[model samples]
Target: MATALVTGGAGYVGTHTCVALMEAGWEVAVLDSLENSSSAAIDAVAEVVGRGLRLYVGDCRDNSAVERALTEAGPDAVLHFAGLKSVPDSVADPVRYYRHNLESTSVLLEAMARHGVRRIAFSSSAAVYGLCKELPVSETAATRPANPYGWTKLISEQMISDVVRSDPRWSASLLRYFNPVGAHPSGIIGEDPEGAPANLMPYLLQVAVGRRAELPLYGTDYPTPDGTALRDYIHVMDLAEGHRAALEALVSSAGQVHTYNLGTGRASSVRQVVAALREATGHPLPCREFKRRAGDVAELWADPRKALLELGWSADRTLAEMCRDAWAWQSAHPQGYRR
Candidate 1:
């Protein structure tokens, strides 16, 4: 069986992808810093997969730590997911974001080169295509990141591309994801953000479970059907499956840098998501309107046809399913993984 090293494997998407990788018969090793995630997540993943994974506790930017994981795990390819992901957080601290995101990738790449591991599947974001003018933005859309977080992703993509161009042995799959929400259907593993969540779904879930008072509905005056921002929210499990497909493609393809946007090809307004969560949790889910946050886009979705065609993967979960599953997880673990 092939082996893979997953950086930040204890985080939200990383944990689910670890389960998927194990189910697909790949030996998995996880390396995480436990900064924004809990090691308990890896335990839950072990339970879900009915097996344990190698856990290396450390930051991705630490060369010695990364090299230790690489040496001990001896993975055939690396699934790079270790990075600070909050956009607002990035806005508040651009240097920290750039340093953490860029340095981690650079160190990891160097370590990969040292170990002769040339294949990687990078976790990118749709934020890289900031302020997209076209609806359902394609892979070829102009990438003009509006925030430091998006700039980090775009710069990382360029770094990977440069490396691949310089060497014929290197292969990469850059998966630009839209909004990833929901949780594992089992409710054993789900998103557990530190402090307040910057994303919408987690905040809504917290409010549904009474952890918070009400949702702060940001910007209700955007040019949309409901005068609220629209986004493509894909289930976390579907996004995990997309990673598996991309990894498979990378294993089979030659030295080429492949990029694909992973989404449901449809947009859900903020009001629509609130309505869905209210129905799912049977909560009134009170909300109060607020001014639009800086760096926020009006509408953003994806034409995920590239991933569908190339990776043979397409997201199939409905918004209702997303909300229902999220509620299942939140209700089961009111205190998150700490519980």
Candidate 2:
């Protein structure tokens, strides 16, 4: 079995991907700072997979720590998911976002080069395509990131591409994912963002579980059927499977650098998501309409044909399933891994 190292293995996507890798007969190791995540997530993954994963609790920006993880884990490849990811927070502290995201990738790349780990699957974001004019954005679309967070991802992709170009042995799969929501069907592990949730599904779950007073539905004036923003919200399990497919492709394909968008290829509006969550939880969720925030896109989905054709992967979960699974985890753990 191939051994893989996951940088942020305890995070939302990271935990689910770890479960997928383990179930696929891959030996897994995790290196996480536990800053925005918790070690309990790793434990939950162990419970779901019926095995324990090797974990290195350290920041990815630290060269020594990364080197230690590389040396100890001895992974054949790496899945890089360690970075600050929040649009509003990134706007509040652009320097922190850029420095932390860039520095973590730089150090990890350096350690990988030193340790002879050439293959990597990076967690990229759809935010890289800022305010796309097209309905379903493709990989060839122009990348003009609006916020600092998106810029960091774009810059990281460039850095990874540069590395792949410089060396023939190096190969990378940059998986640009759309909105990743929901939880594992088992409800043992899921997205547990620290403090107030930044994404839609988690916030909706919180409101349903009574953690928050009401949902702040941003922007009721977008040019959509519901007069709200539309996004391609893919389930977390589907995204995890995409990671597995990307890792396999990276190991097998001859291409040095590959980019694929992992999404459902269908956009769901905020109103639709709210309605789904309300029905799923059987609660009349209260929502407050607000003006569209800056740097917010009106509509954005994915043309995931490339991923479907090349990676042999596509999101298969519906909006209702996403809400149901997310609520299962939220209702079970109202405090999100704390209780």
TM-scores, all candidates, are 0.98, 0.98
Per-candidate RMSD, Å? 0.9, 0.9
**Candidate 1: residue 133 lDDT (0-100):** 94
Task: Give the per-residue lDDT digits (tens) of candidate 1, residues 69-169.
Answer: 99999999999999999888898999999999999999999999999999999999998999899988999999999899999999999999899898979
Stretches > 4 Å off in candidate 2: none
In model 2, how large is the Cα lDDT of residue 339? 65
Top candidate on lDDT is: 1
Candidate 1 TM-score to native: 0.98
lDDT of 1: 0.93
Clashes of 1: 0
Please give me the total number of clashing residue pairs in predicted model 2: 0
Q: Give per-residue lDDT, candidate 2, residue 209.
A: 81
